[model samples]
Target: MPIVSTSTSAFYERARASMKDLRSQAETLQAQLGSGEKLTRASDDPVAAARLRTLSRLESLSSIDTTNADRANADLSLADSAISNMATTIIRAQELATQAASSTLTDQQRAGIGAELDQIHDDLISLANSRDSNGHALFGGESAGNAYSVDASGNAVYIGTNSTGDLPIGDGQTVARSITGPQIFSFTDASGNTTDVMATVKALSDALKGGSTDPAGAAADALESLKQGIDTLTTGQTVVGTRLAWLDVVSERRSTLTELRTTEEASLGGTDIASTVAQLQQTLTVLEASQASFTKLSGLSLFDNLR
Candidate 1:
């Protein structure tokens, strides 16, 4: 049989190595507990760290999308309110036209109605050029200035884009921020002629102010155009209302997606406090026992044992 002899230096080396390993493990567990994260560096779990980074980027983009959705909602709401006011003003103008169409009314009375109609035209123009939440033209279709500009002849002309730009809400979806002025104010009449609300009102006002050979005839002719213009406004309102409803749906979907992302983020990177605490306690206990045993064995010399 071969006899096995252990050297004191080798014994000490083995005992020290074992104690060092236990101490290292205890320190690592304590660090994990302090940081409240399972990973101290990307190298700890490369795939998980990469996934966390991707999620962080998506979260940042989602914040931006939320801001854009809010702006779109605000601008659309402003457009809706302005359109409502314009409809009311046009209806009032229609009432005045009805009074002007009466043959019983004298030219003087018609002139007074024309004066009110002039003010109504101006009010309509102002409403058409209403400002949005960001102070840009509300119905200008992305134009920074007024949607309708007054020429030297005092006629309102459209100087805005034909199409309103779309804003991205989220999930590959977009919404138009507003409807253009012409969309609400211009349409084809029964006579197959294209006319706008502002122009029709201006013509009647001019005619009633003695610019026409027959004031009552002009006022009668304008009734049909005014009715059609009101219809256009109503249609525009419906479009805006539909867009607003779509925004609501998109907002709800976004909220749901955000909740899902939050849950995934927690599952992927959040620390397990209960498990970590238990591991730390077990490591500490083992480290303490190994340390005490090492100290006792280190102090036990051959001569001491013999004595």
Candidate 2:
């Protein structure tokens, strides 16, 4: 009364084994596709999959932080370069003032010095309107346009905002990306003399062209103003350099953190392809042997000649 057919049992067992083999192959392929690697998915091995996901997220976060660091570095470099250019211009102006201050210089000689001063003034104005890598005015105080505009009387006037915008660098930290023109090159001296470097340069140019009436005294006063301007710009450059050095430290730290996170992620989610392939081969061999045995058992006849 018991169902006893060798072929039937063999067929059912073979079908089951075939299904298992197909499932294994499908899983391997899925792992390769998802992870762009073989034997690296959770579906291939749940524990490994979980670890890989965590690592992937951490890597993404690190990448974002790296982008922020790069931007900060670029901004700092631009500011530093601008400050250097300003320093050069200030030095040149000082030299010209010194030459004009010499009493031995005749009116004709003073006029020549005046012509060069005028050109230097033009250069300074151009520098003030200098643009950054992104084409934004370097000292415009966050305005996206030219920092200096020429008035009807040919005076260089500040048309930008009064504040230097700060770039956020994660973890509640921020870096000042620029210095406003008014802060760096415009000031009121100790003697209550309000002087805009650009304006002063233009005034000097006018005086020189008009003729050296009091060349020695005028040159002496201009020399002092030029010195003060240089000092102010130098201070700004020092501050920017300090901030840049600090940023370098922070950037290096972030890089270290990213490497650590990457290592941990690999440990959690990574798979050994060689080991997985070896196990798969063994499983297939066992399945093949079982099928052969089942086939032979189903072919046997207990009473072939009983009839």
Point out where model 2 deviates above 4 Å: 1-7, 18-64, 211-213, 301-307
**For residues 141-175, what per-residue lDDT tens digits would candidate 2 score against the true structure?**
88999999988987888999988677766556777
Clashes of 2: 0
Please give the TM-score that candidate 2 achieves against the real structure: 0.81
What residue runs in model 1 are displaced by over 4 Å at the alpha carbon? 1-36, 302-304
What clash pairs does model 1 have? none
The best candidate in terms of TM-score: 1
Residue-by-residue lDDT tens digits, candidate 1, 159-233: 999999898887788889889999999999887888899999999999999999989999999998999999999
**Candidates' C-alpha lDDT:** 0.89, 0.74
Give the true-structure RMSD of model 1. 2.7
Instruction: Give candidate 2's whole-model lDDT.
Output: 0.74
